[model samples]
Target: MRALMMPHRIVMLAVAAGLVAWIVLTGNWSWLPKYAPMIGQGVWRTIWLLVLSVMIGFSLALPLGLAQASGPWYLARPARAFCTVIRGTPLLLQIWLLYYGLGSLFPGIPWIRESELWPILRQAWPYALLALSLSYAGYEGEVMRGAFASVPRGQIEAARAMGMPRRKIFARISLPLAFHSVLPTLGGETVLQLKATPLVATITVIEIYAVASRVRQDTLITYEPLFLVAAIYLMLAGLIVLGFRWLESRQPRRAA
Candidate 1:
């Protein structure tokens, strides 16, 4: 117990010392306290967008993934092709296309012609969510499709031999096993999506990075707010990883 205690104390002290050194070098703690609320607001926006996009992406991907794996080639092949194109393109391009390019093409879209939807599209948040969700869905669809395909042929055959309907076998055996097999991948994708949230700031969405940039611009300080934002991101990402690790641990270990 004493051995562990000493090392932990030393690490904590070292971290505290490093932070003090950073504050001394930056020389703008006063400004931080003033604009801290703005930063918090930006973080709130980021979290809202992240959660909304992830939920929407996952909800759409599941059915699309299952369809890709089990539907006819006419449906599956197109979905596969769509996924390929989306995954191949950069997300920034996708955002631009959806927000600007498409808007130009359909200037008089219904419910958007001098209407509320136009205002929504003109803002950064909706476009950010749209781009993030669509991009994530494309990647997640592939992961789900692959996971579904990995269901053991033997088990499926036995279920069929027992006269189980396709729907029953899929619901009872395939979906559960596929989810378990793909959990780690899904966790990783979620992490990637979280990281991508910062990119939305480029479009004027006041995410963490955007708020930090505003601070930098106003205070003419280069690194302080950026460092703080980085720290916040690291902490949030760590929590996500820990949650996924807990979930993974709770799952029964497969035979070696």
Candidate 2:
């Protein structure tokens, strides 16, 4: 992966420079102080969205992932299908479908039509979080399935030979080992989900990107707020990378 990406370094650098130049040309740097607070507010919203969505996705994905890996065909097949369908589509469309399409069709339902749930769903946060969680769950489920698959058949057989119950074998050996093997993959998914949070703006979640758009609209300035938002995103992404790297490093590595 590193080798394949090396050639893109210069291209990425050029793009960054061009973006900075555009910002400098179109947006006054001095006004950055004025809009900085609003941009920060947006960043907080972005962070909240990431945290909430990832928590929901991570919690759901574990069971879904395990079931997908080892459950009976009847159970596994539908979970696999659900993951495939969600992963196959763009998240933006998923948000639109949940918030507007199915939302319109189920208008008679209390949650869909006229209750407090309506207030939550009518805004962009719920739909955005739902879409992000579902999207990440699909990818995370694959990661977990692969991790579970990496467990040694011999180990399971030995546990069975020792007369350990299925639950004991899974709880004591399978889950832990699989998790160790898949830590890197899990970390990558988490990081990807973090970056993807900004897409919530498409549904009106008012994430960093949304705030930048608003600032641009209000001030007719092109890029200062955008630059600030990018900086904030970059910082958050860096933190995620570092945190996950630390997690991956701290976990015990499996033997080759």
Candidate with best lDDT:
1
**Candidate 1 deviant stretches above 4 angstroms:** 1-20, 24-26, 105-107, 114-119
Q: Write the per-residue lDDT of candidate 1 for residues 55-115, one digit (tens) a residue.
A: 8998878877888988888889888987899899998889888767765765667757677
Ten contiguous residues minimizing lDDT sum, candidate 1: 102-111
**Residue-level lDDT tens digits of model 2 in 108-147:** 6764576667666656677777888888888788778777
| lDDT score, candidate 2 | 0.80
Clashing pairs in 2: none
Least accurate 10 contiguous residues by lDDT in model 2: 103-112
Error of 1 at 158 (Å): 2.7
Output the lDDT of residue 140, model 2.
Answer: 82
Distance from true location, Cα of 121 in model 1, Å: 3.4
Q: lDDT per model, in order? A: 0.84, 0.80
Q: Give RMSD to native, each candidate.
A: 3.0, 4.7
Q: Give the distance in Å from residue 39's predicted Cα in candidate 2 to where it truly belongs.
A: 2.0
